[model samples]
Target: MPAPAISFEFFPPQTLAASFRLWDTVQALAPLGPRFVSVTYGAGGTTRDLTREAVATLHKSSGLPVAAHLTCVDATREETLQIARDFAAAGVTDIVALRGDPPKGSSGFVPHPDGFASSVDLIAGLREAGDFNIRVGAYPDTHPEAADSGADVAYLKRKFDAGASEALTQFFFEAETFFRFRDACEKAGIDKPIIPGILPIENWKGAARFARNCGTRIPDWVTDAFEKAERDGREDLLATAICTELCSELIDGGVDALHFYTLNRPELTRDVCHALGVTPKADLKNVA
Candidate 1:
């Protein structure tokens, strides 16, 4: 049988040098033809304009669909919706709505007093405001603040119940974890597609720190794989195998789509897609 389709995520660059890197990555992976590429919003909406610019450029130039990430961290609900309306005006038809983290150095997520309270709220508000293909974030194990895995799945169902069209999960290492999460969602009565988020551990140190803070597990096997690879400076090669194996396992388990966190780098993601037998499609007309 055929494997799942693929999507990718990128962050809007904050510097000219970073912008070049992001465009380079986009160029390299654009050939593989992701179903859609999402650009992330910075903490506290710091990069909102930059994100808008990047998403617009991708939509206009890359011939790939773009989903702009929106969050209710620092903006009010009206403000957030205005951004959504702006995206609609810019010709974007999809969004990844998230309850983003607090401004850097804050202890935890503290919602803006006038903003949507959670991702479910954001999803609902977006649905009410426009006809968008909304995607919400899901935690397979548990959100850092979730009481348990059951609670995590329950919350995800709530977001879906609020009219989210799809879910892109937090990056996870264990295929069993995702399978179990999928099962839990099924039992909870959610039938929407839950795309597994895949992050190739190219920077082991940085990924470890972020994963620890975000409550994503770094299994012993994963660590050992990277540690062994570190000794030889072959992270790219090992990343290819690890991500390929993980994706293959998911495909075998019945998933139909993947979302890649590209970190503004593309070779690893491109290689992974190539390994999975997915190829980029040719340019299509802009939505506008």
Candidate 2:
């Protein structure tokens, strides 16, 4: 199979040390020639300025396409659109529009009085405000807030109708989960590109917690294997193997593109990409 097109996601750094780590991650993985690299906003839009700064810096310094994450969490409609306009002014036009999580202590997402009500609304606003390649979130395991899997697909179709160019799914354990979701989307009359999100398990405990919180079902075998690997001090080896196998399966299953949630760590993601025959291009390594 041909090497699949790939993208990487990173969170904006809140501290100086974290900034260095983010740069190091970019340097390590940029040579792999990802189609674009996205920087994420913190929950409740807490890292709005940081995300904008990181996105602009990466776009200017790395010579790579940078997609900024914009969310309707704590900002007003005008506030949000101005950010998109600023991104356009900086020559960054790709966006991952989301109805972000509530604040750390909040019960659930409660839209700001003057803000877009949901991701679909945010998408429409972005479409009206600028010329952007908009990407929206999708749920393969059924969103925690969704009534059902079918509801998730229906909601995604609305997002596309609102002007999103693509959908990037929440990370899931099995490739079959994505295939099933894709089939459902097709049946729902949604023909947009849906890219599976890959998470290289960097920490079992953290990943398990994240999966549970996001409504992603974890197979017992995954738990058992990680337990054994942790006991044998081979967690990294097992992580690389598992992620590589998953990517290989997806590629063999005819997936032509992938978006990896790198979580600001590059080793496992880079290893998995290399295992999938995505080698570094000599000319693309200047992303300092």
Candidate 3:
């Protein structure tokens, strides 16, 4: 099978050391010729300016399409739309609109009094701001804030109806998990592309914590395999093998594209992509 089209998501760096890591990550993965790369907003939109700076820098320096994450967090509606306009002025035309997480140390997400309420509203506002290729988040597993997976699919369809052209799902362990979600979305009449998110299991403990927080179901076999790999001092080997297997299964199941949540660490993701026949080419031409 041909290598699937891929994209990567990176968060804005808050510290100087992290800045180096982000740059290193970009250097490592840029040669793979992704469809696009995205910069994420920090919690509560605290890194709004940083995300913008990173997005602009990546677009200018790497000559790659950069998608800026716009969220309805603490900013007002007008302020949010203005950011979208600024992105357009800067030549970044791809957007990932979301209802951002609430500020740290606060309760669950509480939209600003004057801000758009949900991701659906954010998508609609972005559509009005300019002619952007909009993408929204999806959850194959139940979102922590959602009632169930059915609700997640329904909301993702609503996001598409509101102007999102595609949806990138949260990372899932098993291929069947994503296939089930895709089937549900199709049955619900969603016609947009639904790209599966791939998270390479770099640190099992950390990934498990993140999965729990996001309501991503973890199978017992995965936990056992990681435990054994750690004990045998072969975690890296195990991680690369597992992620490549997962990606292969996805392609077999009719998935045409993958979106990686790189978490500012590129080694595992880079290695997995390479092992799955996504190796870099010396020629700087796009290939899917």
Residue lDDT tens for model 2, 94-211: 9999999998999999999999999999999999997999999999998899999999999999999999999999999998998899999999999999999999999999999999
Per-residue error for 165 in candidate 1, Å, reads 0.6
**Which candidate number maximizes TM-score?**
2
lDDT of 3 by residue, 115-197 (tens): 99999998998888789999999999999988888889888988999999999989999999999999999999998899999
How much lDDT does each candidate structure score?
A: 0.90, 0.95, 0.92
The lDDT, on a scale of 0 to 1, for candidate 3 is: 0.92
Better of 2 and 3 by TM-score: 2
The superposed Cα distance between candidate 2 and the true structure at residue 23, in angstroms, equals 0.3
Which pairs of residues collide in model 1?
32-280, 33-280
State residue 279's C-alpha deviation in candidate 3, in Å: 1.8
Native-referenced Cα lDDT, model 1? 0.90
Clashing pairs in 2: none
Best-to-worst ranking by lDDT: 2, 3, 1
Which one wins on lDDT? Answer: 2
Candidate 2, position 16, lDDT: 100
TM-score of each: 0.95, 0.98, 0.97
